[model samples]
Target: MKEISDSTIVDVHARRIFDGCARPSLEVVVTTKSARVCAAPSYSDPRSSGKYEIRHFPNGGVQGSIDLINSIIRERLIGMKADSQEEIDGLFLDIDGTEGFENIGGNTAEATSMAVAKAAAASLGLPLYEYASLNREIGVPHQMPNIIGGGATMGDEGWKGRTPDIQDHIILAVGCQSTYEEMLCVSDVFHRTGILLQEADPNFTGGRDEEYCWLPGLDDVTCLDVLKQACDEVADARGVAFRLGLDVGAADLWDEEKGVYVYLKEGIVRTPDEHATYLASLIDHYNLFYIEDSFFEDHVELYVEQMQQYGNRVLVSGDDLLAGNLQRLEKMAGRCAINAAVIKLNMAGTVTRTRKFVEMCKKNGFSTIGSCRTYDSPDDTMADLIVAWGCNAYKCGSPAGGEHAAKYNRYIRIDKKLGEIPTFATFPGVKP
Candidate 1:
């Protein structure tokens, strides 16, 4: 066996790059004795509510992150084994020496950590997913593509009018047996939905959000209805099952001081109990496969109630609620507050931390959704992460845009390389 020490790091470089959303982001390159690799960290919209996210721009600009990585981070990482992921990551934490990466910045840590992992894999002459899998089975996860946009993703600058109160109206290719099939399923519905949008409003000018999801001037229910129609058409045409999912992102709609969920565009206000009831109604009416963050992060009781009612059938998931923090997942483990979670590597700050979060989810029997950020990087390492972590499903937004397509295309390549197609993951007690 080749010694991991043979791939010792020699040099490190960092630079500022524009993310998918045109925001400043950090990318890092690590040169090892045996190989060289680079990676960029994905970023969530700063507007999106998350309680545990590390400080993204620690030095006020992306340039500060670049400087820190090139100087202190590089100095520390030199001569360290690229395959010593845990030790190197520990060094990163110790160097920062603050909770939530308050000093070094999570983006800097994430970019550096991923670059090291890739370097290790390259040095070993193994595929990234195979190396990261840690001797576990590499499975192909189903795709969760956003088909409609709302909330923070939608803005008043372009389209005819405001979008629904929900943040992301997504679709799951639950019935597809292969990642390639899932891509086809998602893309079919996405294009059909666009056609339907154009028909619904003659003024619909192909407006979209950062993720390339359609921005139609429709209410939440109407968006769901349109999505359902498109999915139904594709299901009938392809003879496969497709399911609807939602990211209510209730944090944005939550009026904390007033103690109510406000829907400015829909012109409605819902109390906590009322909002729970409304969500239940949608679950029944639409038969949704997943519902994420229907209640705000602090509303553990509401999430518990939702889990109790539909946890077995629906993936009552947490994004803002859990915030990809292991501690938060632990608090909700036995409480049954959530049965699923969204795993964004940036939210966790390091590759080791993200793997720990995924492990905890498995221990609690919670499905994981490897998700992309609103402001994502072109790096397709997330696709490899999905396979390595054995995520049940993954979100790469719509399958159209370059950033999104990069992930899907990479996953498809991995799926093809695997000798046999992996079994598709589905919600408990749900057919699709």
Candidate 2:
């Protein structure tokens, strides 16, 4: 092996496109001094993969990452010693295995993976995830993100199935998804059929369409009506039972002063401290599964208090609270800060780091959800990861688009594939 020096070659680039599928996707390549190290990854939303692609870089995250690598490629090394990649990889231990990637620096999984991966890429000549997962069979794992919108028709409980590998969920809007009128319809159907419908996810987190749709005020007339209409239509169409949700991620109900919950930009202002009581009421009145970041990140303790008071009925969740950072999640979970957390992959560059966050969440008795990002859809790897994490409750829809359907479809396959799910739906250990 050799150490970094001015003379070490850093040339060569190769790439391939792994077709997309019902879930997430990936396009990538690898490089070496002057040869092809490996092939591209395989997984995509085959139809919509055109929406996303990976290349050897005319310029992008991958390319920019390489630039960063080049900058750090020097110094610390004292010789023109041409080193083998395995040897270069061995150097990671000397540096605490944490370098490059400031996006979310909390755990060892991400940073270590990043460092070793770069060496492997330098060795095998492949991109990150692709290279890291090289040669490993990439199977079509299941992905489900069922957003329970139509409250009464869907029911208070959405799903409580035997999880395959992973099963996490997101119960969309409470005002619309958990309206009393809708819950009764769902409950009646569940009672009549003697089916559990879907069990309310203790990890239920909330979301909104603010970033995707136009909702000026969460409590406004038009917004409230729109929310109800959205749920009403789903209940009529899907004819399935669902659960109530709290999607603070939508930030529509965001008021820095008043804190009363708003679905859209409902014009209610509240301090972080002001909102907890109202949120507590939202849970008590609706039997809500969860309220995510009822206030902003600064209000972590307030939300923690909400969980402290009523965690039994509803789990207070966090998305922005940790931003999918393993280290931050470590601190929060260690402190028993909140009841649940959301796992968003893109917040960190690669999947390795994300998994660490999931694992930590499990250790802390923290609940988790498989989430969708603001990016393009049809990438089912996320769905696979979700199922792998054993998170049943999902959030993969906003009334339209293949991205949502793609993951939802994956969930359908999971149930179909597993034959029958086991009981005891908890993260952690062996089969119950």
Identify the candidate with maximal TM-score: 1
- Candidate 1 off by > 4 Å: 155-161, 426-431
Q: What is the C-alpha local distance difference test score of each model?
A: 0.85, 0.40
Model 1 C-alpha lDDT per residue in residues 192-297, reported as the tens digit of each score: 9999988776767888887889987778898888889999999999889878889998988898899999887788999999999999999999999899989888
Model 2 C-alpha lDDT per residue in residues 1-432, reported as the tens digit of each score: 233442243432222222222322233222323332322222212211111121211134333433333344323222322233333333422333433233212111122223333444455443332443334432222122222232111111221111100111233322222222233443233232211111222222332221122212122222223333444555565564334455543233344455544322233445555556655665665555656655556555676677678666566677667766666677777666677777765444345556667778777776676666443345444555565555534455342345554655555454444444322134222110
Q: Give the residue spans of candidate 2 off by over 4 A.
A: 1-26, 29-100, 103-240, 250-264, 420-432
Quote model 1's TM-score: 0.96
- Clash-forming residue pairs, model 1: none
TM-score of each: 0.96, 0.54
Error of 2 at 30 (Å): 6.8
